[model samples]
Target: MSSDDPKGIAPPLVELPISTADRGFYDGFSRQVTIPAKIIVTLIILWAIFFPVSANETLSAANSTIISSFAGWYVYLVAALIAICAILAIFPQTGSLRIGYAGEKPEFSRLSWFAMLFGAGIGIGLLTYSTGEPLSHFSENPDIIRGAVQAQSWDAVRPAFVYTFLHWGFAAWGTYALVGLAIGYVAYRRDLPLTIRSALVPLFGKTMSGFGGHVVDVVAVVATILGVAVTMGLGVEQFVVGLSRVGLGDWLLNPDGSSSLPAIALALAILVGASTLSALSGVGKGIKWLSNLNLGLSFLLLLLFAIMGAGLFALKLLGQGIADYIGHFIPLSLTLFSDEGPVGEQLVAWQLDWSVFYWAWWIAFSPFVGMFIARISRGRTIREYIFGVVLVPSLVCFIWMTLLGGTAIALELNGSAGGTIVNATMADQLYATLAVILDPGTAFAVSGMIVVLLMTYLVTSTDSAILIVNTINGAGDTEGEHRKHILFWGAALAAVVGSMLVLGGIEAIRITMIIGALPFSFVVALMAISIVKAICYDLIRKHQGVPTTAVGVAADKK
Candidate 1:
C-alpha cells in the first residue's frame, strides 16, 4: 500500500492504468468506450433504417417466443440475487461499511439526493405503468373472475396491487442498490474508474484493465442505450396519447385513433432536445431542478388522484397492498410454472407477460440507474444506502401505485367508467381513468398535468442516462462530459425511438430491450458476486490485522 493510505484501509489489488488513446472520431470522445459503442449504435441505426420491417419482425419473434420461454429463469434468478443484496445490507457485519471512507460526510443533501436518484431510477416507468398496470391486472388477474363486475372483488383487487407492488418494490430497487454499492465503493473508496468493470477489480485485479474490461464497459454502454431508448419510446408514446386526449391536435391522432408516428417523432424531438440542454447544464442545476420538479409533480398527481377518485378505498388498498406484498413476498418472488395444469398454465403466461418482462427491463436499465445513484451516493454507509435506495423509493412507488391504481380499480368496482378505462389501450388507460373519475374539465386539466409530469421525468431519465453513458466512455469521468458527446447520445437515442415507432412501436422497443438485457443478466449475477467478494475482502483484512497493501494482504493469505 502507498504511504498515504488511511488507517484500516488497503490498496486495490491492481492499479487501473490511465488511457492515452487519440480522440479522433469525435473531437473529445474517448476511443475506448465511445468509439466501439458508437460504431455498434451506428450499425444498428443503419439496419433499422434500411430494413426496418425485417428488423422489427426478427426482434418481435425473438422476444415473444424464444426470450419469453426462458424468462422464468431470468426472473427467478434476478429476484434471488436482489434478495441477497437486501439480506447483506441488514446483516450486521457488512451493513455499517461506508461507501466512501469512514467519517466522510455525504456530498449532496438528503432531499436532493433522494430526488435525483428516485427521478432517474423509475420516472418514465411509473408514469407509464402507475395506472395501466393496476387496471390491466384488475382485468387479467387470474385470481378472480374475469367479468367487469366480478373482477372488483377482494380476490382481484388484492392481487392487482400485490403484483404491482412486487414489480416496483424491493427486488427492483434492490438491483440498483446492489450495483450502486459495488460501483460506489470502488469509485469512491478504492479510487478506481466508475465503470462497471471497476466493480470487479477486487475479484480480477489487473486483468480488469484489458480486453475483459473493455467488453464489460461496451456491454454496459449498449445496454444503457437500448434500455433508455425503450423507456423513451414508452414515455413519448404516452405523451402523444396524453396530447391527443388533451385536444392538442387532431393530426396527432392516427387514422385508427391511436398516436401517430409524426406525433411520436415530435415528442421525441422535444424530449431529446430538452434532455440535451439539461445534460449540458450538468447535474447540479438542470438535473437537480428537474428531479425536484418531478418529485413535486408526482406528489401533486398522486394527491389529485386520491382526492378526485376513491379516497377511502385507496387508503384501504394501501394498507392491504402493503400487507399482501409482505405476505407473499417470498413465495410470489420465487414462484415459477410450466405448462401443465390450468392454474400452472395461467401462471406461466402471466409470468411471461408481466413479471418476467419487468425483471428483464429493470435488469437492462440497472447499469444506467445504478451508476447514476452511485455518483450521487458518495459518503453513505451500506446500511444507509440500502435503506434510501431500496426502501424509500419503494415506499413511494407503493403509495403511487396504490393510489393511482387503486383509484382505477375502485372506479371500476363502483361502475363509473371503470370498464371503459380497462378497455382502452394500455397507453391511454391513465387518461381514460382520470376522465371517468373526474369531471370533464378536471380530467382535461389533469391530462395536462400528466403530460408535464411525463416531460420532466422523460428529460430527467434521458439526461441522466446520457451522462452515465458518457461517464462510462470517459472511464468514469463524471465532470468531463463533452457537449458533442451529450448531443450525439441524445440524437442517437431519439433516432432509435423514432425508428422503432415507425416499425412496430412498443413491441419493437421491447424486443430490442430484451436482446440487450440478456447479456447483462449474466453481468448482474457477476456483480452480485463481486460485491460479496469485496465485502468479504474488507472484513477479512480488518479481522486478520493484515497490512494496508490490498495486494499484499491477498498475497499473505495465499
Candidate 2:
C-alpha cells in the first residue's frame, strides 16, 4: 500500500478497532470502484436530450403497471418495515461503520451534517411539493381515502398530514439512510472505494476483484446518472415555472406548457452556464457557499410564512403533524390497502406517484449520495450519522411543510389564504397561493424572494451532484483529480433537463425517473444484502481481535 496510485487514489488500507485482517473480507472489500462516472452521466444526459420522446409515454405507463404489480400493494408495505428494522439493528447515537481513506474523517458536524445530507438528498423535493401537496390532499383528504371518514370531515385535515407523513416518512428516508450506512461502513470502516460495487464487498468477498465487480459498479453508476438527470430535469422545470409565476420572464409563460419549448431550452442553457461557472470555481468556494445560501433562503421563507400565513394555526399544525406522524407512523408507513375503493385507489396511485417513485429516485441516486455520505463520515459513529442523516433535517423539513402547508389548508378552509392553492399544481402557484393569503403590500417582494430561492437551490443541487458523481466516475475518489470531470457532468445535466423541458417538462422528467428507477430497485435490493453481510463481518472482527477503527485498520494495511 502506498500514498498515491495511477487514479491518484492512495493505496488501500484496513481500519477497525482490532488488529487482524480477515484476508477474504479485507481483500474483497478493499477493491476499488474504478470507472469514469461523469462520462456515463454525460451519455445519459445526451440520450435524454436526443432520445425520442415517445419513450416517455411508454415508461410512464410501465411505471404504473410495475408499481401497482408489487404483490397487491402490501409487498411494498412489508418491504418498508423490513428496511427500518434492519438498519436500527446497528443504530448508533452518532456514526455508523466506515472505511477511512487519506486523512479524511467520514463524519460531519450535527448541523452541517443534516444540511448536506438532507439538502443533497431531498431539498429539491421539499421546495417542489411542500405546499402543493397539502393543498391537493385537502381537495379530497385521506379520511375519504381510508374509508374511516368523509372528504370534508376534520378527519380530512388529519389525513392530509397523515398521508404526507406516509409519503416522506421512514419508508423513504429509511431507504436512503440504509444505503448511506452501507457505503459508510464499507468505505471508512473497511477502507473500500466510494463506489456501489464496494457495497458488495461484505458478501462477495474476494470474488469482487474481477469482471463481476466492474459489472456491478457500471450498472450502479448508469442507474445513478439517469436517476439524477431526471431529477435535475424535473427540478429545473418546476423552478422555471415558479419563476415565471413571479414575473421572471416570458420564458416561463407557456399556456399550453408546449409553446414554451424554446424558453425551456434557454433556461437549460442558463443552468448549464451557471453550473459550469460553479464547477470551475471548485466545491469549497462556490458550491458550498451557494448551498449555504439556499439553506438560508429556505429557512427565511419558512419563517416569513409562519409569521404571516396562519401564525398560531401553523404552529399548531406542526405539533399535530408530529403527533399524527407518531400515531399513524407505523401503520401508514407499512400500509398496503387492497380495498380498491376510490380512496384506496387514490392512495395507491399517490404512493406509486409519490412514495414508490421517491424510493426509486433515492435508489437511483444512492451511489452518489452514498459516496458523498461516506466521504464526509470518515470519523463519525453509527448513531450520530443516522441522526443527522435521517432525523435532523427530516424533522426540519416536516415542520417547514407543516407550518406552510398547514397554513395553506387553513386559508382554503377559512377563506383566508384562499382556495386558489387548492387548484394550483405546479410549484409556483404554491407561492402564489401564499401571496394571496398574506396579501401584503409586500406581495411582490415575497414573490421575488421565492424566485431567488429557487435559483439558489438549483445551484446547490447541481454542484453537489456534479462533484459527487465526478468522484464516482473518477474511480470513486474525489479531489483535485476530478475537476474537469465534474464540469462535464454539470453541463450534461443541464442538457438533459433542457431537452426534456422542450420535449415535455415535468412529464418528461417523470418518465425518465420511472424507467431509471426500475433497474435501480434491484441495485437497492443488492445494497440491502451487502449491508447485512457487512454488519455480520463487523461483529466477527469486533469479537475476533480485528482492528475496527480507521487508524488501526490503516496501520495493518502497511
Candidate 3:
C-alpha cells in the first residue's frame, strides 16, 4: 500500500539532454564542462607532483607481453586482410560494399570531408609510426616479439604496408561507415536518435524500451572511453618524445617516460582543459578549426621531408615501395597464410601483432570518429557517406605513408641518414630519424612542430572522445552535455592512462589495447551482419512491391 501510494517519489526516466537549457540537464551528461576541465587539471598536477624516475623489471615485462600480443594478432596477417576489404569497399559496383547511405550522395565536397575525417582519425598514428612501421616490417629484426629474426628483409615491407593498409583500410573504415550509415540512415530517414542503440533498432524493436537496450548503450560508452584513453596515452608519450628530440630539454624522456608522470599529467591537464573548451564550442567551431590546422601542418611537414630529406634516396626507395605495394597488394591482402599452412604462420603472427590489434583499436576508436562524423555528415546521402568515410581517408593515408615512410626507408638504405633513423623502432625511430635527415637546428625545429602538432591532435582526440562518451551517457544528445560529465571522462582518461604508463609505459598500453580490441572485433562483426540484413530487408520490401519508405520508417520505430 505504501509502495503504491508513495509520496514525493521521483518518476523513473530514461535520458537527459546534454544541452545547457534542457529540463533534463546533467543526468548522465554534464553541461558546459568547466568542472570536468578542472578534474583533468587536478590529475595533471598530481601526476607532475609524483613523477617516477625509472621503470621496474615488472614494468618492462608488461611492455614486452603487451607488444608481443599485438604482434600475434595484428602484425601482418590482419593488416593484409583489412586492406583487401577496404579495396572492396571502395568499388561501387561490388554491391557488397553498399552502405546505409546507399540511396543518396555525399553533401560536402569530397576533399574537405576526407581531410577532416583522416585528420581526426588516422592522423595520430601517422605522426609517430608512418615511416618507422614500413621499414621495421621490412627488416628481419622488426620487433616480432618471440621470433628471432634480425632484420625486416626487403620482403617484409610489402606485407607490412599491405597489412597496414588492411587494418586502416576498408575493414576499419567500414566499421565506422557502417555505424554512421545506420544512425545516419535512421536519423536522416527514420528520425531515430543518433546513438549506437539506434543502429540496433531493427533487432530489438520496442523491446529496446527496457534494460537490454540500456546495456547495449552502456557497452558502447565503456568501449569509447577505453579506446580514446589508450590513444591519448600514446599521443602523450609521442608528444613527449618529439618535444625532447626538438629540445624541450632533459625532462621529456627522463630515460623513463612514465617516471615523470606528474609532469606528464600536468601537461595533459592543460591539454584536456583546452580540448574540453573546444568540445564545448561544438564540432564546427573547435574540432573543425583544429583539424584544418593539422592539415596545414601536415602539408608543410610532407613538403619539408620530401625536399630536404635527400631527394634521390627517397625517390628510389619510394619507387621500390610502390612496386612492393602494388605487386603484393592482392597476395598480401588475401594472405591468411597461417602457421598451419604452406604459406607459413609468419604472416599469421604478423596479423596477431598488427591487424587484429588495429581492428580492435579502430572499433574502440569508432564512437569518437562516428560521433564526429555524425556531426559533419548531416546533409549528405548514403553513397556520399560511404565514399567519404572509407575512400577519401584511405587515399590520404596512402599518400602520406608514401612520402614520409618512403623517405625514411630511402635514407636508411642509401646510408644518407646513415641508417640511423629506420634502424630504430617505435618512438626511437621518429626521434633518431629526424636527427639523421635534418640539421640539428632544422631537425629540432621540425621535430618540435611535430610535438605541437601531436599535442593539438592528442588534445583534440581526447576532447572529442570525452564529448562522445558524454554524448552516449546522455543518450545521444547532439546539442552538447554536462560540463561535469566531460571532466569525469577527462580525469578518468588521465588516470587510466597514467596507471598504465606507471605500470609499463607504451608497451603496457599497447598490450591493453590489443586485449581491449579483441572482444570488440566480434561487436563490429555483428554490426556488419546487422547492416547486411538491413540492406537485404530494404531489397526484400522493394521486391515485394511494398512501400520501401514505409518499411524503413517501420523498421526504425521498431
Candidate 4:
C-alpha cells in the first residue's frame, strides 16, 4: 500500500497537510497535471477573457502568415509523412506486430472499435465539411481556376470531389493513425503512461518524466482543449442553422445575420449537459451507444440523400472522383508552389485556406482523436490499426462527401438552385442542399434528423475529448478517471465556446484551432520519429537474441 509499491498499484508522490488558512476548495483531478500545466492553462484562460478579439486577430494573422509562407512545403511534408507511416505499417516485418502482448486479443469488438474511432475521429467535422468543402473546391480550386474555361464549367465537378477527398481521405486519417500507433505502442506495448509524452520515451528515455515530458503533456492538453472547442463552437453554429432550417426561425439568427447569443447559450447548455453525462457514464456504455447510434443515423441520412437527391449524378461523380484521386495522388501529395509565378501564388493562397487549414486542424485533433483511438485499439495489430484508423475512415468520408457534396454540385450544374447552394454559408450549405432535394415537409424532417444526429455526434466528440483530456491531466489514469474531472472539462468547454461566441464569433474558433495546432505539429513529427526509434530498437534487440518485451526491456535497462 506504500507509494512506491509495484503490485500494479501506486500512490501519490506527495500529500499536503491542512493549512492554517482555509481556502476550502476541493482538488478532485490534479493527480497528473504539473504546476506548470496549471499555470499555463490559467494564463490561457485569462488571456482569452482579457483580450479575446486581440487574441483572435493576433493568432489568426500569425497562423495565416505562417501557413501562407510555408504552406507548400508544410502541407506536402505532412501528407508524405502520414503516407510513409501507413506504408511502413503495411510491411510484413511490422504489419503483424500487436499493439499489446503476443497473445492478447483486442479489448473492444471490431464493430465497437471502428465505431468509436470513426465517431471520435471525424464527428461533426464530417457533417460540417461534407457539403462545404466540395462546393468550395468546385467553385474555385486552384487547378480549375488555372485551367481553361471548360475547367470552370461543369467539368470541374469531378476534380472538386477529388480535392475534397484528398483533404479528408487517407492523409487525414493516416495522420491520426501515426500518432495513435506511437502512443499505443509506447503505452500498451511498452507499459508507459497513456500520455502524449509517453510516445516520446523512446527518444528522451528518462527525460520523458522530467521537464521535457511535462511540456509535451501540457502542450497536448492545451491542444486538445482548443481543438475540441473549435469543433464544438463550429458545430453549435451549424446546430443553430439547422434550428432555423427546421422552422425555429430568426430566434437562432441575429439582426445582422450572425448567430444569436441566446441561441448559442441554449445550444452550449444542452451540449455540455449531455456530454458531461456521457463522460460520467464511461466509454463502455454511454460513449459506445452514442457512437453506434451516430453511425446508424449517419448511414440512414446518407441513404436518404442518395435516393432522394441526385443519385445517378453522385454515383457517376464518385467513380470519377476515385479515379481522379488515384491518378493525381502523387502530384497532389508532393506539389508545392513557389512564389515566383501567378499560379504558384494562387496555389499557396488556396492551400492556406483549404489544405494548410485542414492539415493544422487534423494535427491539432490528433492528440485527442489519436489517443482516443489508441485507448480502444489495445491488442490490435499494426496492420489492423493502420487500416482501421486510416483507410476505412477515409473511404467512409469519401463516400459521405460524394453523396452530400456531389448532390449539391449536381443541383448547381443543372441550374436548379443556381448559386444558392454554392453561395450559402458553410454552416447553412447542408440545409440549403436539403431544401433543393426534398419538399418543405420532407426537408424539415430530414433537417430534424440531421440536428439530432449532429447533437449526438457533438456529445460523443465532447465527452470523448473530456475523457482524453482527463486521462492526460490525471497522469494517464484511464481506469480511475474522476467524474469530477469530466464535469470540470465540460464546463470549461462550454465557457470557451460561449466566450468565443460573445467575443470573436467563428473567427475566434478558427484562430484558436490553427494556433493550438502549430506547436503540436512538431510534437506529432517527433512522435513519428519516436515510433521509428522504438521499433528499430525492438528489432535490434530481437536480432541480438535479447528480450524485447516491455518487462524484458526494463530488465535489460536495469
Comparison by lDDT, 1 against 4, better one: 1
Best by TM-score: 1
Sort every candidate by lDDT, greatest first: 1, 4, 2, 3
lDDT for model 2, please.
0.62
Model 1, range 306-417, lDDT digits (tens) per residue? 7887778888988998998999898888877676764666767777778877888888898999999998999898989999988899998998888888877777777887
- TM, every model: 0.93, 0.84, 0.78, 0.91
lDDT per residue for candidate 4 within 398-476, as digits (tens), equals: 8899899988888888898878898888889999999988889989999999999999999999999988887776566
Model 4 root-mean-square deviation:
5.5
lDDT of 1 at 540: 69
For residue 247, model 4's alpha carbon misses the true position, in angstroms, by 2.1
Give candidate 1's total backbone clashes.
Answer: 0
Residue 524, candidate 3: Cα error in Å is 1.7
The model with the greatest lDDT is 1
Model 3 local distance difference test score:
0.60
Query: Per-residue lDDT of 1-558 in model 2, one digit per residue for the tens?
Result: 223324332222342121112344222222233234435556655665566565466556766676567523333633653455346545551124433433455444555655666556667777777877766565565466667776644567877776676666555566666777777677765666666666776666655655666666666656666666666665666666666656667766566543266656666677666766776676566766776677788888888877877768867777887788888666665665553755667766666665566666666776667666666666665565555566666677678778777777777777754456666555565666667766555776776776677666666667667776655544455553455555656666766666666656666666566566566566667777777666655555555555555566556567
Give stretches of model 4 more than 4 Å off: 1-35, 38-42, 70-73, 149-152, 551-558
Which digits, one per residue and each the tens of the lDDT, describe model 3 over residues 1-558? 111234422111122222322455455442333233334335433443354333244335644465455444443433433443344345543343223333444455655666667656767788766776676665632234334433544444445565455455565676677666655544544455566665665554545444555555555666666677667777777776665666557765665433366657766776777777877776666777787788888888878877866455545554665566557656644444345644355655555556555666777777667766765676664555677677667666666666677667666666676767764546656667677777788877888788778877876687777777666656667675467666666767777677667666665665655555555444555555555555556555444443334334344345
Between candidates 1 and 3, the one scoring higher on lDDT is: 1
